[model samples]
Target: MPVSSATSTAESPPAAVPSATVPHSWEYDGTEPFPEKEPAAPRDRGERLYVAVTAAIVLAPFLALGLAGWLLWGRLIHPADIVLALVLYTVTGLGVTVGFHRGLTHGGYRAVRPVRIALAVAGSMSFQGDVIGWVATHRRHHAFTDRPGDPHSPYRYGTHLRGQLRGLLHAHVGWLFRNSRTSAARYAPDLLADRDIRAVSRAFPALCLLTLALPFGLGWAIGGTLVHALTALLWAGLVRIALLHHVTWSVNSLCHVIGDRPFRTRRHDRATNLWPLALLSFGESWHNLHHADPTSARHGVDRGQLDPSAAVIGLLERLGWVSDVRWPTPDRVAARRV
Candidate 1:
């Protein structure tokens, strides 16, 4: 949900690694008040178009849930639809957690070129955003954290009850509708310079189509009917997207406000470890440790914590698909604990 801010002071945890080898230098204490700003206006035609497209992406899948329920009531959902949805959800969720967030944004591991490209494409298909844009925004989130520059900090509106309520909604989904674009040139220069990642970013629209089409095609082939295909599109395509969208957004909204803060982060950085979301978010809900050590390959470092994304990275590392993985050391974890 966040990243490292300015480097820690003499009293801060020395073991924590800032993302992409950047050093934190911001001097704010945790006591600083959040600076509120006027809402952004979509003044240009392109800005309006951006808002329209974002609305379609965010709302269409959510609306599909009602239709999915209607179809479920009619007993139209087949075993094939369920299977396809599970497969796609797992693939795309890991693509975002393992690929976009940990691997690309934080530089947690060095992946083989092919594996890197494949992960980028898979993450792109998640319909979050283009690979480069997602990385840039996430990096910026880390850089500014809950301060004024954070794109979707729930604390942006201050810590009051009314402001917190409004900020939660803003962080959850309202941020997507705003035209506050994170510049890839400033935040994700590495991705911008990569030829393969650039191509994947440009192919985002095509991949969005492919993500839906694959389920439809598979369902039609397996069930031998247009009805099966349509159901699969509903369940695996739109419904799956909606679930992932809310879960990811929950990390940004709920994780910060609720859950246990086992680790210390920069001033005003209120990341928390939300266990209820751990299974669904593939370990990304271990937000406290993540903000504490942004570059660590593993977020769920405690016993009995389920982290499928970390497991996947471990598997890839063993297979020689990735190296230099910034797995959390026991001493480092202990040092950062509150």
Candidate 2:
């Protein structure tokens, strides 16, 4: 439930620095050292099967967009469908941003047992992968960042224009199909050991089904027609998932390559703060600040920067649902500023 900041030396990369503030279980022992060559893509049947399933997950909703657009043209969409879509999008999006990312991955604050489990469940419904795996992959990303060991860095190709273009595509979505796996045992041992979190991770497939079924059930109840249920599934289920998926992925692809870096990060780490994505990403577009100080509960520390995730954390803190929030201090922010 608690993790603190990691320490780094000028010679040591961020990945090698373990947290001094957390117990052994909570500590991220950083993945293998940076500058290691990327693993060769495995060509086994298992890898093929993994890619096939990933294609279904990533492409099915995208194909649904075409159907949804056709339905919209025919005036088949109900306002109830739009409203339901918005509601589910907000819930699942925040679940990924606040729940999977800030709370579970970085340990920005300590939530009560119920809140913690609830957030994990919510994030799981976003179709992002289970809680433990998601946290483990993200921790591995922070460890290696843009270096060779990093899983989804845009710099994986090169700094050249053509390479950057290819990398943007890879970073945005191609990385999901890769068979390179982050070890939950090494990176997220704490979550692996926790009975509650393990249970949530085990329930990821059920949550995926439930995420879609809820909209269908609600639409059936509201509109009382089979057509209504199907439309709701299209709009509120598939379309919403696609929108949130790209937005979250844009943080990995666009945020790194195309935004302002107001905060300094480790060498080769080019994470940036893209303000246009602030609202949609629930303040996670402040990627530069996050790379600078991963443990900070709030990323939009500067004035006029909107961070809805931070607001939620603040509200939870006020209600005593969470505690030990690592809100950025003035000195801390100033020190990291470019």
Candidate 3:
């Protein structure tokens, strides 16, 4: 969310105050009153359908290519493939978890100039849209939560099985296809004002190309074969994106519908922690704590819960690159107990 500011004046004597007595009148005002919130625009059903169809078409070829690569070159799990997968996973996953979600979305901690730029670039390479767009959508997600204005609420279609299935698909990827985009002015004004962020967001298409090309380039450099490059691209590029997309989307879908809600939230805000997604989502599956304390740097505040993203933020703090970290205190967590 964008930072807010307030203006206040010390108490002053009223114009008609008695000469022998002091009078007090104080006034304060917050940043220019936010514009009245406009109702969300109506979604164009034809456009929505077109976007969904086009996404299927674009994504279908990649799925076929992945399957072919797996059949032809995935017979033996090469050590190189494993290493590359782990490396790419860490880089890209952290780029989203620590960089996009924590650093940018919540301002969990302050990052130095270099780290901030690098994080934005790395997150862009994840192909999850530009920093400003991502942050804007996320802020909206938190603001409206599971309500009508939420961009990807699983409950938008009701609890019936078929409705849920449709909602799941919508939350997972369908939301991206629609023509409607979040308003950055309302959600991410701070980022919009930054020239560097705008430049990075504008370079998103180029960064996406690099994401696919880098893995292939590395594969050929290491394995010295076109087949190796193809396999790496499948595993590290397409499959990885599909997996991350699902995991992140689950926070919007499954996380809100299933798992253990150990912490309390506002009515209708049903976020939960699903252990199965821990490692895959870089500890983001600890959704219960996340919603309970949205600004807390650590989502996995409970014992034995693994949160690599929080760990990285802690490390950055120690390095003095980030300050004002919002680590959750025991009292804060306890107050939100379900």
Candidate 4:
């Protein structure tokens, strides 16, 4: 196969940083040594709900799956839970891959208004931060991977065992609570300029509710019982989120620390391809290839690597929902192979 001519703008020179003109008092890129004003304390009902939901998801799977077994308890685990979990995981995971990372961040292909908005909404259900913030942080990660400025690098701390453990923890989830946030103004000016994306960002809380409620509603209607609804909410909403969180976080922590570096990338960038997570991560575990070629659309470029996200993008393209698809060629991939 040959590399497609539809490569994205990521291969071009960096965009101008209009954020440099932002009001100084309000700027919070988390890079300044001392900001004049701190990011305002978390307020709003939505903020509180976000915190609580995140906590529940992180703790629920353990009690439902592990602690209950320890006490010889049963009931929390339902067959329907597993089925819903897999189904929701597939939908929301692709939301992050095809929607947030590839479509928004990398511009691997172009989507029409309806398709773009749908992607954003579906990804919002994943309960990751809004699109602008996610893209900003990710772009920052690419700007400075495994270096001082990478938002979620596992190597943030030194290589000592204690440091590595601490770094892993930070990369996995601790970084979310950090005072410093990636500036969407600096990194995602394209998204910030889009009124539709801004509106989608504002609707994230409602989208979260929709994500949780849809599965539970379907379960109640299908199973005709409150227990069934609860189980669906438990598995598809909370447990599924936890599973997605760790897998996405693993790409941040584990992909950098472990796996095979079969492709070369920026000097000092530690990204590697972790095969164990290929299917679960929807091909994003091909971190080495992704880091080597950021806008290729397909991360798992090798034969039999199984990139479902790429396949989805392909389907969408053929359906006329996406255009300028960037399919990789053997020559392009061969150039990056170590």
Estimate the Cα RMSD of every predicted model relative to the unseen true structure. 5.7, 6.3, 10.6, 6.1
Which number leads on lDDT?
1
Cα lDDT tens digits, model 4, 1-338, are 01122122234333432444345354333223221234478666876765676566566654554543443356565677678889889988999999998888887888988999888887888878788788778877887677656678776666678778888898988777553567787677788778898998999878888888987997788788998897787777766877898899999999998998889998667899999999999999999999998888999987779899999999999899998787788999999999
What candidate 3 gets wrong by more than 4 Å, as runs, is 1-77
lDDT for every model? 0.86, 0.85, 0.73, 0.77
For candidate 1, write residues 293-332 as lDDT tens digits: 9889999999988999999999999999998888999999
State the weakest 10-residue window (summed lDDT) of model 1. Answer: 1-10
Instruction: Please identify model 1 stretches exceeding 4 Å from their true place.
Output: 1-42
Worst 10 residues of 3 by lDDT: 5-14
How accurate locally is residue 62 in candidate 1, as Cα lDDT from 0 to 100?
Answer: 96
Tens-digit per-residue lDDT, 242-297, candidate 2: 99999999999999899899999987788999999999999999999999998898
Q: How should the candidates be ordered by lDDT, best one leading?
A: 1, 2, 4, 3
TM match of model 2 to true structure? 0.90
- Give me candidate 1's TM-score against the actual structure: 0.90
TM-score of 4: 0.82
lDDT (tens digit, per residue) of candidate 3 on 1-338? 22220000001111232233322342211111112134646657887775775586348545845695666574844456557767877888798888888877777777887888888888888767778888878877776566555678776666677777777777777777754578888777778888888888999878888888987898888899998887777777776666666777777788888899999976567788998899889899999888887878899988889999999999999999888788999999999987
The clash count of every prediction, one per candidate, is: 4, 0, 0, 1
